[model samples]
Target: MREISLDRLRTLVVIADLGSFAQAARQLNLAPPTISLHVAELEARVGAPLLTRTRGQVRATAVGQTLLERARRLLADAEQALEEVRGQVAGLTGRVRLGASTGAIAHLLPSALATLQRDHPGIDVQVQVLTSQASLAALRDGRLDVGLVALPQTASKGVKLMPWRRDPILAYVPADWQPPARLTPTWLAARALILNDSGTQLSRVTAEWFAAAGLYPQARIELNYNDAIKSLVAAGYGATLLPQEGEGPELDRRIVCRALRPGLWRSLGIACREGDGDRATGHVLAALKHLRQ
Candidate 1:
């Protein structure tokens, strides 16, 4: 029996994603005929058709879908194995793409990334600031190598969540607005609020926190980015609940962060697609853990 080749599996995965042999060929930088041969060989090895080809579109069959999943995992593993052989003796030299919330990018990640760069000057890190949902999607699609996300109650399909640190969630109020010594649900509800946008874990948690207090806030303004939310609060637009790290010089001067009476907190964590647990991934995780301490 002929062994299945990584080359064929890659072709299968690319065709599955790109939805056309020509598109797959273009993506892989291979001739269309070569891609056809690779898919044919893969079908023969598996003893079933992996794809349904029509006029211009390619669709994966049940078996094809299964193989595509395994093929992506296999390809990611093979790439990681290549890096393992290269090792840290290779001095962590590779592009590491990371996704993080804007707040994390502004305060939480800079120091950690600085430590990583200082220790491994060869590693080129690309950080994308996005909403938590966007970050999860990018990580699953293999564009982002890892993510720094606030722990969501429910995990996404292909990622593993690991707690990295906890940040106090404080209420940021305009300096001119003085509140009672202790913040009550009624008092909080009376104030207008700014919130993180829909579809974000932060926004969901914020809703949960308010609901738990039996308080529905007055008119709420939604913003997609935490940095923007802070800016709005700093400009005295409205108070917002934000992670403590959101209190920077700009915010401190114009706003005051009051720690919640019962101490509301958010958990920030390191996350990666489940199968990306290679030595380099582990090393990066270590770097995050080191920073957390």
Candidate 2:
């Protein structure tokens, strides 16, 4: 059987409403013959006599009433879907998938997301916590719309990176330790340390900082989540080096943050597929850009 057309469905609705073929045609701006053909085609497709004439007035048969009810719902749903698509195209509403490291998600994304909520309330940003490498891979595979990634990443095909923000790395140590105001690699290496997981960009950056000073320090424990690392630091488990993002969150009373002596910095970049993105993605990109310092 052939698929039913919305045009024919609409014609039937108009005829039922007006109860006259000529009146429906005038309302629809269709010829009387075309209107008659529309009903005939609908009846033929359903294999039923859909209309009855009583005193020159038209009305639907039982089967036609059932089909008409369903058709009305279908038509209303189609219209709503089109309106939503139009809203997305206009950058008024959409769901944008975003990827970022746990650290960024904790310290950086809140303000950006708040601004988005204020300005573009219809744009829903879905965040996924991912390592920089994982985020880039997701972008390459079309799984993510935007990624806040560590800078100095290896260039990948079909992905583009834009410099977003740079923050100084700091040492988070137990307050009772009374560490120096500025921590050096040698000073830090001598202490037990909680560190980011080996797979993370921050770990590599931290390693390079220590290596440049001719020191290679082993971590007391390595984990990916920034809050967990800070919790360990607060508990006096070990000190860890992490970026001090945008004034940062309030530190635990037992934890104090210190600047690194050599001023190590962690840089971040926004990554997206290297082509035109949908308007919703562009709106989110703009919101992220507003967070740069």
Candidate 3:
């Protein structure tokens, strides 16, 4: 048997609802003969009479009633599927996968995400904690929609990088240790340091800062998580240098943050696939740009 046409199903449904062939034809904006042909085709496909005329009123047979229920569900599902696609095309709803470092996710992303939520509630942003290199790699591999990366990165193929923010790298020390007003490379070098692991771009940036002063100091312990490093600093484990994101949280009472004498800074950039055209990612990228310092 051939397929049952949605138009024919609709005609039968309308005729049954209105109880008049003339009314169904008018409602469907189709001629009376077309309506009759639609019913004839539908009944031929079903191999049974689908409608009955009694007392000059139209009604459906039992088989037609069953088909009407299934047809209504199919029509509703088709309409819903189209609406969801339309929402995505309009940039009103979608899922965006974003990658960033723990520091960026903690201090820089909260306000931006809150703003995004307020402005585009239908957009869902999924954040993954990753190093700058890992984020860039994921962007290249099509595993990430967007990335917040450390700057001065060597250009990668198929990745576009845009300068986003530059934050001052400050010295975080134990409160009991009376540090100088401005911490110099020499002063910080004398103290035991809790540094970022060698794998991170932050570690490279910190190394360059010390190398500029002809001082290469060793760390007491190396770690990647900024919050954990801060916890150790509060416990008087060691002093560390890290960027203070704009208007970040208050420091622990046991720890003190001080300016660097030579004013070291950490630069960050936004990374995404070159020539990418995703609406949800575009919305997330815009929200992240608002955090630029």
Q: Backbone clashes in each candidate structure, one number apiece?
A: 1, 0, 0
Off by over 4 Å in 3: 1-12, 20-26, 29-58
TM-score against native, each model: 0.65, 0.98, 0.85
Expressed as tens digits, the lDDT of each residue in 106-162 for candidate 3 is: 999999999899988989999999999899999899999899999889888999999
Pick the lDDT winner: 2
- Candidates arranged by TM-score, highest first: 2, 3, 1
Candidate 2: give the clashing pairs: none
- Please say which candidate is ahead in lDDT: 2 or 3: 2
Collision pairs in model 3: none
Q: Write candidate 2's Cα lDDT for 1-293 as tens digits.
A: 59999999999998998899999999999999999999999999999988898999999999999989998998899999999999999999999999998888888999999999999999999999999999999999999999999989999899999999989999999999999989999999999999999988899999999999999999999999989999999999999998988767788999998999899999999999988889999989998999988
> Residue by residue across 1-293, what tens digits does model 1's lDDT show?
67789989998888888899989999999999999999888888889999997887899999999989988999999998888658644546666788887777877676767787788776667888776667778888988878888785458788888888887778888878886555655667788788877677777777777788886665478887777777788788888887776334455578776767656778887888887455555656667788683
Q: Is candidate 1 or candidate 2 better by lDDT?
A: 2
**Deviation (Å) of 269 in candidate 3:** 0.8
Order of models, best lDDT first: 2, 3, 1
User: Global lDDT for candidate 3?
Assistant: 0.91
